[model samples]
Structure formats: C-alpha cells, structure tokens
Target: MSSTTETVVIGAGAAGLMAGIWAARAGQKVVVLESTAQAGKKILISGGGRCNLLPSVADISDFYSGSSDNAIKRLFRTWPLEQVQMFFEYEVDVPLQLEGETGKLFPQAQKSIVVRDALQNELLNLGGEIRFNHKVTDVKKVGGDFVLACGDNVISAKKLIMATGGKSVPNTGSDGFGYEIARRLGHSNLPNYPALVPLATNESLLTDLRGISLRVEWRAEKNGKTLELGNNDLLFTHHGFSGPAILDASHWIVRDKADLIINFTQVSSEEWRQRFIDEPAKTAHAVLSDIVPARLAKALLEKANVKHDDRVGNLPAEKRKAFIDVICNYKLAISGNRGLAVAEVTGGGIPLDEVNLSTLESKKTSGLYLCGEILDVIGRIGGYNFYWAFVSARLAGESTK
Candidate 1:
C-alpha cells in the first residue's frame, strides 16, 4: 500500500466513500481508511436495508435545524438536489425512486447493499484505495501535511478529510472519535446531544399502553404555550411514547421539565364533550375501539373511570365532559430521551461557523476538511441527512481537487 496519497478520506461511510470517489475521479490519488472490517455498516442498516439515498425535494432549507442558516444555505447551493441525484444515477449507477410523501429516495430495488456496492465499485474503478480495519488513533499536522497514525503505521497525505460520523450507533463504528481528532487539530466542538431518539415518560399510563399505536396529533407545550405541533404515527412503549411524530419532537422537549401534553382526540375536547352530552344515549356506550385500538380504548376508559359496559345514555354530563378532557388532552410527563444507543442522528458537532462553507475545511486547520455527521449539520427524518452527507463531502472533495 502507498504510504502517502494526494488526499486521504477517513471513515469510509457515505460521505468518505463519496469523497474518495470524487477526488479519485478528479485524478487525485486517494486512500480511504475504515476502522471496521467492512465499510458502510450504517448505510447497510439505514431505511431498514433499503437505504434512503436522497430526498427528491429541491429545497434544502427544510432539512437542517442549526443556528447557521447561511452555512447550510451555501453548502446546498454548491451541490444542490438535482446534482446529487445525477451523481448517483450516472456516476454510481444506482437508480433512485421517491418512496413517500416526504420525497425520500430509495434504490429502485430497495436494497442498501446496492448503494454501498455501487459507490465502492465506482471508487475502485477510479483507482481509490480503501484500507479496512485501519483505525486511526491519532492525527497530527507535521509541517505542511497531515499525518495519521493507525495501528503502528503512520500515513501521510496532502489533505485529510474527517468523515467519521457522530456518536450515534457506536456499534456501527462511529463513537465520536472524530470529535477528539478535531479537538486535537484546534477545532472547538459544540455540546453534543442525542437527537431523533425516543422520549421516555414517567407517567404510569404508558406502562399499560405499551405496544399500542395511534394516528394522533401531538403538540409540545412549555410554560403554558404550545411550542410545536406534529401529526403522525404515535406509539406507546413501556417507557413512554415513540414513533415518527414523538421522535421528531424529542429535540425540543429535551430541555423541558419532562412534561408534555398530548392531544389524542380527533376533535377538540370542548366540541366532543358538547356532542357527547347532546347525544349521550347514542354515543355514551359507544366502544372507543372503533376510533382507536381496542386495547388503547380500554386503557383510556379505565383512566377516565368509565366502565366498558357503561352506556353513554346513562353517563352524567360531568363524567362525559371529564372523559372528553382525558381523551382530547392527556398530559404525560416525559422523563428523558433514549440517548445515543437508539438515536438515528446526533444534534451537535463541529460548529458551522468554524468551517469554511465553500470548502468544508476548518477555519483553524489548513489542509483539513470535516464532513458528514462529524460536523454540526444534522437533518430531520426522511433522506435529508443522507443528502447532507453527499453534498458536504462533494464540496470538500472538489475543493481539495
């Protein structure tokens, strides 16, 4: 193996592999160092093995949530959606299809291995070398170039790109090692936290409602005001609620006092209460199983002290109103999130302001680039994060070329 190359890409993930492919295609000698026995472990598991390649949405603003809007804006503008799609379609030989309402792109065959194989094949075709089981322990700047020490071998390169992902999914080989490397290279890290994880609740109701799922609208409330509203599949677990809607809201709810109010009713409590009182005989004994799952309905009724056999016609007005209140707005106190183990992505990393947006090179370190989840840029669910990985790595590779 050549000890030195024009460019060295670390991590061999989506971003690192893409960078190696692009830089090598541009005629720069490139080498990729991966700690694991094989690369693309995360990619293999993403989208439940289908691999959401990219989002079909053209607008980039909908993806990110950090304070650095300008940085994100510039990064997307450099490598926009259309260009990202074309790269996979033509260069990588992976045809993509839009899966759902959010425009998430998956392989036409819905196999993640296809995407990983395609990218790796393209990189190899362009003469890129990937060193597997090479875990980089330390990175140092010696004079003008970067020297990486991995398992007794010191590899030097003209430029070093850190595409090591964040602390999420440590078993996949991302354990925030890149953050230590960045700090050693004079980059300041923002406080890292788990994002896109499940929320845990201290409430007793959730214990009985575990395994129950409902289509409901949930809103995050703080200091007597609603912070955000989301509508999607909500699930009850032994700890608390999870699913797309609950997980998405966990970011904002992390700092709160573990208290969140959920609206389980299809309509407002006041409206439902009025209707129930007006037609108690017709609705009071109505089984909630039709509106919600049988188990969930039983739990809700039990919570409201309403017997399953009690006729709506026999129910008192006050009791009917109380049932409506519990059904419409059931308050549950969230204890915490599930942490990095179950998180799909992390929230913070290398701050955007510390890196040059056009190049993805650290403002503090010359000849060093940071990409992927290692940087602070994180996206919501769907294929936004994958897009960011591709675009950011493309900019870094092109700049180094």
Candidate 2:
C-alpha cells in the first residue's frame, strides 16, 4: 500500500525507533520501516542476549572518526548520555539498572526484550507505526519529499532518517543498505571495516588454549611508535583471540597491521622477576602460576625454553633475563580479523561532517538525517554504540519539530 507521512524512518533498530517515537510525540505522523521480520534483532543478541543498553561512561574521547570529529563532539554535548538515560527513565517508563562500575546499563530483567518492547510500546503510544519486512529497494527524492520503494508499494515522507546500522552481523539485518542510499544522495562515506571484532592469527598454541579466557593486555607498535594498547579479558579460540581485549584490538589491526605484544601477566617485568628470584627453589611453572593462569604459565615457560625446575637465582643473568622477557612480552603476529559476521559493530559510514550536529539533518540533502553505526563514529566495545543510537536519533526526531 502506498502511504505518505510527515516522517518515514528506515531501519527500525535503536535509532529509527527513537526517531519515530519522538517525531510522533512531537505531533508528526511517522512510520518506521524494518527489513527484518521483527524489530531490534541486533538488540536481542547483544551482550549475549542481556543487551547492554548503555555504557558506564560515554565520554567524548571514547569515540573515533575520520571526517567529523568536531561534529561528533558537538552532537554529544547537546544530547549527552545522561539525558538519554533520563528519557528512558521518565518518557519511556523503563527503569534501567547500571550493571558495573564502568556504567554499563541493562534492564532489571536483563533481557533485550525489555529494551525492545519499551521502545515499540512508546512509539505506538505516541501514535507512530512500524512496518516490519518492508525492505527498501531504492530511494528517490522528488521535489521536497523522500520516495522509498519497498517491494510493490511506495512510501513518501517529508523527512527521512537512515538508521539501518552498519555491515556488522548481516544475519541480524545490518547489511549496509543504508550506506548505499546515503551515498547515492551525495554523502561521502569512508571505507568501512569490522570493528569490535576478533583478530585472526597463525599462533599454533591457540588450539591448546581453545576456550580459555584470561585477563591480559595487547600492545601494538606502529613504525616504532605505540599505536594501540588494549586491556581486557582475552579469550583463546581455535581460530584466534576472541574476548573484549582482542575484540578491541581489531580496530587497531584494521587501521594498520602492527606487531603485537601480549602481556599475559599484566604485571611489571621487574616485579615478576623478583617473584622468580624470591622463590628460587620453586619450579618456573609454579612461580609463574602465582601471576598468570596455571595453563598459561606452563605455556609461557615452554615457549621460553626454560626448564620447569630451573633455579631462578642460580641461572645465568642472561638466561634469567630471557625467561623474564618471555614473561613480560609474549609476541603474536596478527593476520586479520574474523570478519563482519562476528563483529559487534562496523566502523566508517556517512561522516558526521555532512550533517548538522544540533539536528542530525543532512547538510547535502534538505530532509535526510543519519544516525547509529551507519555514521562514521564507531565507539569502543561497551554500551557507547547503543548510547549514540539513542542520542543521535533523538536529535533527528526532535529536529522535525
């Protein structure tokens, strides 16, 4: 059926839903279109189904962009995370619980449905409508309104919000169709890559370490300079590293390949050396076990070619340093990433510089707006991405007034 509205939002994820709700509340007739059979599929599987709704902290520095750094900062200043949280609490009527010290938030039920249902209900309550399975085949702006072709029916709206997200997790419907629509409308898009994804490696020990997770640090150096430093839990998988720290490393690895140093101990070399010296009678594995996991301790000792019973104090000074070196700086060669299928979000899209920060309206097109990961600002692993979706969409929706 062909329909016309004041605003037609594409992709009923976090941003589109928010835009529809706010626009409807602002007394504009709105309709949100979704490609998937259901809304918020990505939300359902995020954070392993609990769906981390907001980060513990979403500072300006947490985000990165190539074209619109200033625009991102400006957007955050106007629509801060605190304001979004307040909106959820008061307007949406969903009480959110902060999960950890870092300020990650989730619903009290800890299920993604709570967050999704709240958004759907709020949009409906405000007289906004959602059209599921309405995948757009093409978009054309004739005169003053956006014309979207979805199968046999045509939809027209005075304004449009592209919130289809990025290329990450295509199975959940973030397949990058929005980027094409925005690009055709004269918006410049940077090269997109998998972000918050795992890095692939050729390390043979990964097979042995399969399923083992340890808190560690990944240090990458580029052209004799420190390029990235990631500190979080690293999970060893049959293929490569998968955990928060390694997932964080994917961002750096994608920019430029760098030499990696895995600090299994997450401790100082001098301090760890002292432990070995103080316990000369103990086996190297036993001494190392005090700092890292026992299985990793054995692996590190084996990689260093140090005997398990080697006396730390009696060993030659050079040999002792070599053992300590392995403990402090275990190196790994990064090949690539596991690809977008397993990535949490994508990096790069329509740069924020092409949109007005205060309203999230397109600078190139009169009525087109952009939000969510479909924008160039890709944040670190946390609730930061979700926070951006809510804040940017709010600005776009309120701009309709």
Candidate 3:
C-alpha cells in the first residue's frame, strides 16, 4: 500500500523546506522527502556556514534567466524581499542581520544551522512531515494525482513540487535528478552549466600573483562584443580567480565561451598611458605601485619585459604601450571553470516559461510545479539565489493550497 499526502515536495533543501512550510501552513498534509539524512546540506555550507539567506536588494536586472525579464519580475514581485524578511524574523523566529558591506542577510545568530533548524521546526510545528532518507527516484502524473516512487515505497500527492535543485554541488544531494523527472514528465530543460564558480587560468603571471586581491573591472567579451562589466573585488586563487567579481561574471564566461579582460588598475588604457607620460622620470614600478600592490606592479613590469627600475621616459615607445595595455586591459587565459562540484549554483534548468508565472505550476502537467535552482534563474554572488528559492517556493506551496 502507498502512503498518500495532499502535497509532496521533493528534496528538502532551501526551496523544498520553504514549500513544505507554506503548504503545511495552508492546512495541507505535506511530506517533504529529502534524499540525504540531513536537511539543507547546501545551506550548512553557504556563506562559510553563516548562511547568507537573502540579498539586500533583488532587482530583476540582477538575475539572469532565459525567460523574459518581465516574467522574472512577476515571480519576484509575488513575494517581495520585505515580506521574506518578516517571515524569517516573525514566522521562523530567526532574526536577520544584513551585512552592510556585501548586502547579504544572515541570521542574527550568524549561523547557517540556526536558519535551517528554524525552518524545519516551523514546518514540523505546522504539521508538515519531512521524511529524510526517502529519496524519490521517479515521479509520474496519473489523471490529477502525482505518484512518486521512493525505492519500494510509493507516495502519492494531489500536488507535487519539484525542488530537487540543479546539478551543482552534487554532494548536497541535487544530482540533476529533478531535470530528469521534469523531462520524463514532459518538460524541456535548458543547457545546464556551472554558475557562480571560479574560472581556471593557466596564465603564469596570475599563478605567480596568487593571494593578491584587488578591486578590478572584470569584463566578459565574446567575438567583438562585450557582454558584462562587473566591478568588484577579485581574488587570485592558486588555480585562477575566485571572488565575488569572477563568480558573478562566471555564467557569462561559461555560457558564451567568453574571454575575460580585467582592468587591474580600474583605469582605461588611455588614462594609464597619460599617467605614465605625466610622470616621465618616475620608474614604472614606483608609479604603478602607488595605485596597485607592489607585487603586481613588479610582475606587470616583468610581463611587459620592462625593467623594474625603468623610467617611463627612457622606455621604448612599444614597451611603454605594452605596459599600459598589460595594466589597463589584461586578458586572462581562462582554461575552464572549477566545474559543478564546487559551483555555488547551477546555471540552467527548466525554462521559466514552462511554469505558470503566478503559481509556478507546470504548463505541461497538472498538479506539477518547479522552483529554486531547478529553474533557469542564475543570481549573482550575494543571496539572490536564496531569494529566488524562497519566493518561488512560497508561491508554489501557496498555489497548491
């Protein structure tokens, strides 16, 4: 015999939990099935465990989606950030504190476990049952009911919310299984890729400059067109670049096979050239060091084949031009990304158009809905991803109720 429920939400991650909570609140018998023994595994590791739960601001322009921008706006507008904050503070009993510097909102306790536990407790208190270790292997819609197969046991629900997340961070239990279920249930998935992951570079200069961090103007260029210009702090990792700037711009790099051009000095080539000419007698290293780190100044000179103590006025015309270009428009040889294993979020999933804008119900299958990273919405470094999860899941759960 199969156990049945009013609502069955697959994967008890951020989206899954939120959906379960809302569904239970609406008097539905909800069972949130999690593959792993623990809930919110990804949440446990987010923001280094502090858990950046929401972004300070969630502009539709801040998110990337294959769906229309207006569609994205409507979804976000459904549950604004203010209401989300209130829900965490009052309903979940977890006060949120915003980090002024990053515009990321964390629990006042500054703990990821706190946020996870609070949500789980709220759901349980509201009569929602979370069956951990009950990994639903397959789902099928028969008439108006959805039948979910979790190994030998079968659980059926009038409404099924697919919050299994995307392929990124597979260890967190989202192994792209949600897409498979969606495909089998009659939905098209977009090309999936790792988003918010660090870019890999084999540039010897960048390798040597590991640990050197600075504010850079990072640009993604493909063919002759420039895609995005992200201005943020960029950190040089042992392998490549990993920071807010790189991670935020990574989707563009991965999607378009784009080239990365960084303005290390945050100045244009003409401005840097003019500065060099103005300080004709000053050594290039001396003038550049004031603007950039001393180590980078020395490395740039070496890369340009100019002596560290070479005066700007004494440098050959070609050498001076080369040095300016190196500093102002440095191109990184991006070999590849760190892949989905270490990615913060997955880039692609089911197209948003496939789901109803207001309710997030599947257009192809009745009583089916999709939310979270399972949809092709990629948010930037802050808490925009979580913002999407909370908002979308809330709508799905409420709509089912």
Displacement of residue 359 (Cα, Å) in model 3 is 0.7
**Candidate lDDT values, in order:** 0.82, 0.82, 0.89
Please, what are the lDDT tens digits per residue for candidate 2 over residues 339-373?
Answer: 88988988878877788887889999989888888
* Residue-level lDDT tens digits of model 3 in 143-257: 7788889988888898899999999989999999889999999999999999999999898887788898899998889897998888998898999999999998899889878
- What does candidate 1's lDDT look like per residue over 1-401, in tens digits? 45667899999999999888778867789999999999899999998899988877845445544546766787889887898899888877899898776578999989999999998888898888899999999999998989999998999999998999999889999989989999999998877788778888776866678988877877778777887677777889888888877776776677344345666757777677666667666543363666787777777888888888777767787787677767778776677888898888887888888888878888989999888999887776778888989888888887787
Highest TM-score against the true fold, candidate: 3
Clashes of each: 3, 4, 0
Every model: Cα RMSD to truth: 2.6, 2.0, 1.5
Q: Which ten contiguous residues of candidate 3 have the minimum total lDDT?
A: 1-10
Q: How accurate is candidate 1 locally (lDDT)?
A: 0.82
Off by over 4 Å in 2: 1-3, 276-282
Candidate 2: residue 345 Cα off by (Å): 0.5
Runs of candidate 1 with Cα error greater than 4 angstroms are 1-3, 58-61, 255-259, 270-274, 284-287, 307-322
lDDT of 2: 0.82
Which pairs of residues have clashing backbones in candidate 2?
Answer: 55-103, 56-102, 56-103, 56-104
